[model samples]
Target: MMLKRVAVIGAGAAGLCAAKHVLSRLNRFAPPVRVGTYANGRPIHSSMYRDLRTNLPKEVMMFPDFPFDSRLNSFLPHHEVQRYLESYCQSHAIRPHIRFNTAVDSVRPVEGEEKTTTWQMTSSDSSGRQKTETFDAVFAKCHSSLSLSPSLSLSLSIGEVLHSHSYRYAEPYAGQTVVVLGAKASGLDISIELVKVGAKVTLSHRLPRITYPLPAGIQQSSPVVAVEDDGRLRFQDGSVSAADLGLEIQDHVMTPLYHFLTPPAFPSLFFIGICKMVCPFPNFNVQVQFCLAVLDGSVALPSRGQMEEEVRRELQEKLARGVEHRHLHMMQLEQWDYCDALARLGGFTPLPPVIRSLYEEVWRQRGVHPQKYRDLNYQLVSDARWEALN
Candidate 1:
């Protein structure tokens, strides 16, 4: 059996690659399949901030077959990434297949007498016209939401409260006493950006104190525990403060997924770009390949029950090892093994030594000087070495 039609939700890096790869392998299908991409906006609703530069260099951030322009900086600003995605769509003829400004409302599986299932997708366009379409398969690359602590609730009378999702520019927060929760990438980057713009920034996280140098006016503190009745903030370490502005920088966790890709109960649907703390773009490349393999029967997955059990065991191990429930999908140092497993199962080349070396070097630089890391430039000299340019 061959897939006759596929729907790719979101036109971001992952969705674009999914569509491109599907189109590339049209000859493999008995009959060529039609692919459609849906996006709620202009296809650039990435969680990118105005001044944000990529943590990983462009060398490793690119798909294996496509390279970013060598003339561009190693660490590119957010807008450059958006432009690259736009260019990717145009170059691969993906834009014509996309329904921009259309939001997918629901996706439900229609069971059939045979084992195969079809998906009914309900979506609305910018004009509020609703439409329903059926597809042979679906790739959901939709954005997830940031999880905030349950105890902290803010009233309208409280000062500005913003999730990192709504964060765009630091100019709007120039003179406020900002308390940023979560010391992860966005939290740290936004705090530094705010401090540069004269905001008195207090970074609060449950993790151990960060060793990287932070600019003056940016201080670290314990995580916020609660919001008092009098509008005061309570901290984990029994500290209290009056916060004028709050920024939640915690990473967004994708809803529980099987193997971080498939929903256990629904094998026809797949998710990409859900794993965190890894080289994102390259990881997405391999994930999309694996999904295609599953669809084309090139890779055989276990029975539904077995796959669900495997996902449960993986999550249990992470939880037993003290990993947060929400962070079950985080690969971190385990990304290499995870990527290799995907490539092995999906019949793709593993990441090269150059990508690994560059990835590690950037990580080390980030640890040593989080604020100054992006200021340095790097070039991959070979498969095993990267040189930092002065």
Candidate 2:
């Protein structure tokens, strides 16, 4: 059987990585497959901010086969990571497969009696030109929606509101009181950045107040309860703050995934980079290889019923253990095990020990000093070793 074509959605790190892997291993499959990528923006619309730097160091953040420039800092700015991705695509000959400024409309299964089914994708470019194409499989690497709790919904006229998605810099909110919702990484980072530029920032979340020492202009608040008609922000603990702007850090919730890959009902469709708190580039590398293995008949999946049942069981176990549904896919300390499982299942090499050690060290550093962690430097000495260069 010939697996003639594959479609990858999004042009970000995950999509580019998938395209590179598919193109490189075309000879492994019975028949060579052609891959194409669809991106919604011209230069790529990633959720990167102007002052953002990667929390994970470049040592473990790179694809296993393609290392970042050795002279680059361990913690690189967002543009450097973007440039690394561009370089990866160019080096792997993936540029020819990319279709920029094209947004995917829908992907659905083409139903038939065959055991292995095909997929149909509809996409439209900026010019409003639409095209429908069919392929043996589809990989969706697009960004998911931010999970906003229902209690925090406010009227449109309340005040200036924005998701972290639209946040660029801190100068715009200088001298104004800003309430940032969701105290995740972005929430903490943005709050710190805002305070550096004179924004009175309040970081609010449902979780326990963080014990870290914040900058002078920044304060911690209880989770936001409601927005009053007078533009005051009410907190769960009955505190109120005069709000001029609101920024919501997008939270990701697992969407009933099977092994964090595909929905059992649609085996031909897959998603990458949905898991949180993992080394993204390395994770994408393993996931793409495993997905390709499944496609080329190298790995056999269980029946649809079995796959769906397993997903339910996993979610139930997590909920029983006090894990929220929204955090089901968060692989903070579990990332190493998860990556090893994918490698074992796909017949690929497991994550190197050096990567795991560096990842754990960085995780500890972030907790110890969230504000100053990135000041540390690192060097990779071998597959199983790394050194902290202070």
Candidate 3:
């Protein structure tokens, strides 16, 4: 069958990477796959606000063949990464396929039992004219977090309880006592970044422990307890500072649960860039591991329970050996990152059963089975693999 035109939703790392993979192998296609790119915003790689440098190094974050400019060091700033994405697209000749400022309105299967799907897209042009377009099959490149509509409001002041989405430059929050709510990588990174810039930062979450990066450059360390959460954050039973972070984790935990419990409410988009995997062997290898999973089909769109089970199996084997297990953390983080990147970029959530099953079928057919299908013998967030999962 002739491959229909594929529409890639987001222009972020994974979306671009997926596009790159397709473009790289375009010549192999018999019908010549036509690719089109669409995104809500003009090209904000993950909506990276100010003070956001790649958590992973340039070497790891960069595409395999195309390296970052030699002059720039490892940690490329957010803008630099955006610039790199632009360059990557240019160097790979992906610009012609991209459409900026376009948004996908709705996507549903075409009526009647047909293999083809229809994407009814509504977008506006520079002239303020609205237009609708259709595509055969679309890659919902948006992130998964978008599924949990920002509608859920908490008792915490609306101004105070902001999902990582509302966050941008720290300038507005310079002197005010700020409480960053999240236990995930983005929460941790944003909190640290805020603290670095002289903001009294408190990361509020339920996770009893956190894997902290030490001063000696040791990637791993014993779990640290966060004390002083009323707006201030004290670590490892250290002295308390002013303004403690709120320790309310119920909402945080409930967010993911809500997503799972209410499928219709919570879009099952992939979440990526959760954390950087630190193997003493190489370094921050999150992006590298992500690319591998994508290419291997171990991780892909439309997450399925079986596919997730397969992923868990691989985690068991990799995590079995403390050092080797670092790869598992890397892969897991990439999975989360992909979810987020896809939703933000694609403007659609995979929604369980459909998208997840799609990923399962694709991964299974691609020989991306779990390394080991048995139950995990040990816990994932343990001491041994801490460094590997930095």
Please give the distance, in angstroms, between residue 295's alpha carbon in candidate 1 and its true position after superposition: 0.2
List residue ranges in candidate 1 displaced over 4 A.
Answer: 28-45, 142-151, 252-256
**lDDT for each candidate structure:** 0.79, 0.80, 0.42
When summed lDDT is taken over every stretch of 10 residues in candidate 1, the lowest stretch is: 29-38
Q: RMSDs, each prediction? A: 2.7, 2.6, 13.4
lDDT of 2 by residue, 57-130 (tens): 99989998899999888999988988998899899888877876677778778886766678888887777788
lDDT of 1: 0.79
Task: Give the TM-scores of the predictions, in the order they appear.
Answer: 0.92, 0.93, 0.53
As a whole number from 0 to 100, the lDDT of residue 2 in candidate 1 is 50
Error of 2 at 350 (Å): 0.9
lDDT of 3 by residue, 25-122 (tens): 44432211222444435433343566765544453345545667856755456788778878887887777666665554454445334332355556
Could you tell me the TM-score of candidate 2? 0.93
Order candidates by TM-score, high to low: 2, 1, 3
